[model samples]
Structure formats: structure tokens, C-alpha cells
Target: MPVSHPDPIWVTDNDTLATYCTQWLKLDAIALDTEFIRTDTFYPKPGLIQLGTGQEVFLLDPLKIDNWQPFAQLLGSEQVVKVLHACSEDIEVFHILSGNKPAAIFDTQLAASYAGLGHSLGYQNLLKTLLGVDLPKDATRSDWLQRPLTDIQVSYATLDVVHLLEVYQLLQQRLKPMPHWNWLLEDCSNLSNGDLYPKPEEQWKEVKRAWQLRPRQLCVLKVLAEYREREARRSNVPRNRVIPRGSLWPLARYMPDNIHSLSAIQDMRHSNIRHYGEEVLSLIEMARELPGEQHPKPLPAPLPKAAKEHGQRLKRYTSQKAEELNLPVELLMLGKILTPMLRSRLEYGLFKLPEQLQGWRRTVFAEPMVEQLNQPEQ
Candidate 1:
């Protein structure tokens, strides 16, 4: 049966929120979820925060409630375990709300993944699969920022957290006997780390076609992406609003030195070029003028036929290892994460494993894989 709570009390101001959070701090655990919109903004526009304390459900109107400091304190309190699911964006909303991240969180989705519930499982599906309950997801596209949310919206949002406590409890029971059961706790604790979001200076690596750019072109793309990230943070607009990413590679490739040359780049919006005209020109000119020694290292050429053959061996190794452990291949190490390093080793004879491949992954697969990674294909 679906768990039921009293009709959610709509808390629109600080005093009620303070009262609720005061009681919430006394609890050992709570279920949490957020309804937010990020359609046109760099930062998510918080609409509603749905909190479940096992005994009660509270719907906090972030638009109307200005003081979230108490709830933020509750989040940071050592005793309270905040339960959530697939919570990366929810962390962002909480950060914007109170300048704090929830500490001691249990991500049921991640826990369920380990419990044989599968990767990236949705809350509704987990409920159906584990608890035999069907959760309605009708209000998924509702405008949460709009006031006077309909009954369906409230019901949908409330359902997001109401049964989460039940799910968390069931997941805990299911996960308890697994070999790496504690891995969920470790992964959950790591989620609270301050570096969950992308660093602006490091954002350039996420751009498409980035690896194709040469040393100087890469330098230009890096600086341009950094500028856009910082600008998005400053103006609270999406990065694409500043300059579309596809436009970046061409600008770097052509080394557009003036407004006219920039205009010739197919994707650079004319209005954006005019607005940031001088600044963009100066950046390109600076890259062009960099001394040869100061230029970044050249991009490695494509892999040779022998290197391509070696990749097949790596793939077979990953599949065999995953089968032995009875874990998803991705949980071992994603192809994107593993193959890139292998390619780099073949291309430049350099090897650096991704930070994510450490801890449990290192013990299981990484050590053996690294030993054979450099061996010629059999």
C-alpha cells in the first residue's frame, strides 16, 4: 500500500519553517526532494522544497519563504540523515537556498543500484519494483515557479518525497547483505563534497570536438570557456546565451582577429559579437601572439592501426572483469573514462586514471587492467 501522510501543510514563511526545522533537527532521518526550474538560467530557479520527516510532510514555498537558514542548519546537523534520490541538482537548489549542502545523505537511487535495482533508477520505478506501488508522474512538466500550483502538482511533488522514506528503508534492508553494501554509504558521503559542481576553469574539457583542436586553438577554447562560465555566474544567464559552444571551436580555429573576421564565423551571433566584440578580439589576438614555447602542447595525432587493435583487448578485459564481479561494466569504469586514458597512453605513452576509478574500482579492476594496458594486443 502507498504510504499516506496528513495533507501537506503549506509553509510560506520563516516562523513556520523554523518550527518545523526545530522538530526536524530532533529526528534521526528525513526524506528530501526539490521542484526547481533551470530552463533559462545558469543556476536552478528554486520553486518548492518537499521535506519528509517519516512522521510529517512539509511543502516549503521557496519563493515565499525568505529565511531557510534554520533548515540549512538542520541539514548540516551531524545527527540527522537526509534521504534523497538522484540528488545532484537538489544539492544545487539547497546550496542556492541556504549556502549549505545536506550532510549525511543517503541516496536511495544509488543504494538501489547496488541492491540490483539497476543504474539511474527513477523513484517511481523503484517504488513499483521494490514496494509494488505505482506513483503518478503527471506533473513532471508543470511550471513549479508559478504560484497557486494545482492539486495534481502538489500531489505529484509530495509523492516525490512521501514514500522515499519507505523506499530508503527497503533499500537498506535489500542492500545490507551485498558485498560492497558500505560502498553506498561511502558514495553518499562523498556526494556532500564541496566540489560536486563543475569548476569554471576546468569547464573547457567538456566542450565537444575539444580533442581535435591544436595547442594554440585549445588554449583559446579554454580561455573562452572560462570567460563564458564566469560571465554566466555573474549575469545569471545560461552559458549558451553568452556564446554557443559550437561557435567556440571555429572561433579558435579561424583565429578571428577582428569584428569582421568574427562575423564571418558561421555561428557567432552578430549581437553577441557586437556586445563582446573588443574583448573577444583581444583574447584571440593574445592566443595568436603567444610565444612558441609558451603555447600549449600539440594535440596527439589519431591512433595507429596497432593501437586500434589494442582497444579491442581492453574491451574484452572490461567485460570479463565485470562478469566476474557481477557488476555493471560502467560501475567498473566507463568506456569514456578508460578508453581515453588508454588512447592517451598509446598516443603519447602517458597514463593517468580518472579520480573516480579509485577506491572500490581500483581494488577490483584497475590494478589488473593497468598491468595489461601497455601489453601489445594478443
Candidate 2:
């Protein structure tokens, strides 16, 4: 059983935060989580920051505080280890809100996977598995921006971080006996670097199958995607609001030249066309006129037989190894990570391991994978 503390100090102002910082500095590791709404806005509006230090939980109200210097310093502090569960988005929030990423981070979800718990385990399932406590799901959809949050909401939010400290401690203990602790540390260190925040525009090409389009379609998509990215930021609304994902296929396929043609496209509705029609048409025109060499050629699809064989082999190998280790197959290798590696090896006749497959990963996870690949078929 875990101890429950409900006396969370709600720090709303600088004076209160300063007082809290005095206490916060004394802590070695703090569990952290954030509540935010991103439905209406392009970027998430952070409503609350929940923190715990093995003793108590605190909810820092972003709506009330004007200065977050103390909070930023705490995140950047070398001595404090900030713990979070599946913290990619939370890290993004910290970067956007505090303009600094934490110096030390321990992501419990990642640790759970490496420790053979499971890959991408839901927080609720993880809590129950590790702590034997069932958390309430009622507040999952609550309006975090609403003032005077209910006791249930507060309790739910606080619980997110309160047990995180204990979970981290438990995972650390388990990982001490495993060789993958160093890999987890390296991954966590990379998460703390904040480099993922400012990705280059060309990187968007990797989204879905943007690379599969013809050169002309690729040109149009590149331009439209760039436009969408800029517009999403400028309008402070979600990218989907400006242009939905379904609309992209048509935009890339037709590469329409005028508003009339763009509006007539089946995927784009008249109302959306009327709203963003001219801009879309203009972008298409630009792509059509783009320099020939500048247009990206469609990447050739892999041979059907080889592609199918490699995928089956990789899946069988990973599944068997994961079963032997009592770990989830997905924990051993995510499809997103495996697809590219398998494709590269089959096509290029060179096996360049994914960055995630390197370092301690190669030792604990990749060695058996390589062996499985080399084994002759029965």
C-alpha cells in the first residue's frame, strides 16, 4: 500500500513559488506531470503542472503565475532528477512553457518496457501492475482550464505524479540487475536535450507516406505541408483545423491550379475550400512551377517477395525472443523503428542498426535479434 497525501500547496504567484522553491531545492528527485488542452489551439495551453517528491504533490497553476523562473531553474538544476511517465509531450510542454528542458529525466514508461513489463503500457495499467492501485478514469476528459477543479479532478491529477516517485524507485531497483540501465540513461539524457523541439521542415516528409507520391505530387505536398506548418503556428490553432489529413492525399494527387479546381476536389469540402481555397490553390501553383531537380522523386517500393519475407522474419524473430524474455513483442521493437531497418537491410544489402538499436540496446535486445536473423529456416 502507498501513502496518500492530499495537502497539495497550490502555488499561483511568484511569492508562493519562491517559498515553494526554498523547499523544492532540498529535494533530490521529483515526479512531474502536466495537464493541458490542445483541442481549440494549435499549441497546447498548459493549465496545471503537477509535481511530487515522495512526500506530497503540488499543483502549480499556470493561469495564475506570471513568472516561472523558479520552476525553470528547478527543471534545469543538475542535482534534481525529474521523473515522468512517457514524457515526450510533457517535455515539449516544459520546453514551450519554461524555455528549458530538465537536466536529468527518468521516464518510467520507457523503463517499464526495458525491464520487460511491456511496451507503451497505459498509465492506468502500469499503476495497477506496479502499485496495485486502480486510478479513476472519470477525470480523464475533464476541462482542465475550468477554475475550481473538482476534488476528483485534483485527486486524479495529483495521483499521476504522487506514485511516479515510487514507480521510478522500483524500476531503478529492477534495472540495477539488468544491463539495459545504461541504455535507458542514454535515452533519458537524449530526451533532456530539447533537440526534438525544433525539427527541420523536411522532416515532415516522413509523416505517413508522403514519400510515395510522384515528383509533382511530392512538390505540391512539400509546399502545402510547409504552408500548413506556418499557418498552424501563425493562427495558433491545430494543424488539422487548417487542413485535415484526408485533404492532403487529394492535394498531393491533383496539384490543382485554381480555386475552382481545388474546390471541386472530392476530399475537400466547399466550406473548407471557401475558407482556405485561394491559399491552397496558390500553393499548388507554386509547387507546379518549382524547379525540376528540386522536386523529390518518388522512392521505389521494395520488391513484394523480399519485403514480405523480411517483415515476416523480423516479426517471428522478435516475437520468439520477446516470449523467451517474458516481454511484449512491441517492447522488443516498435514497427516504426523496425520497418526502416528491415527495408534498408533488404534493399541495400547493408544492415545499419537504428540508433535505438545501438549501445546497451545492442547488448541486451539486439544480440538475440541478430542471431535470430542469422538462423537457418527449419
TM-score of predicted model 2?
A: 0.88
Stretches of candidate 1 above 4 Å error?
Answer: 1-5, 302-305, 344-356, 371-378
Tens digit of per-residue lDDT, candidate 2, span 1-378 = 553556787878888987787788778899999999888887788888999988888899988987888888989888889999889888877877788788889999888987888787778888899989787777877799999999888888888887888899999999977656876788788788646434426634754666568888888887887777778788887677677767786788878777777766755777567778888887888788888898876765644576777777778777777777666676567565676767676866644466655554566667667665656658
lDDT of each: 0.81, 0.78
Superposition-based RMSD of candidate 2 using all C-alpha atoms, in angstroms: 2.9
Output the lDDT of residue 19, model 1: 94
Per-prediction TM-score to the true structure, in the order listed: 0.90, 0.88
Q: State the local distance difference test value for candidate 1.
A: 0.81
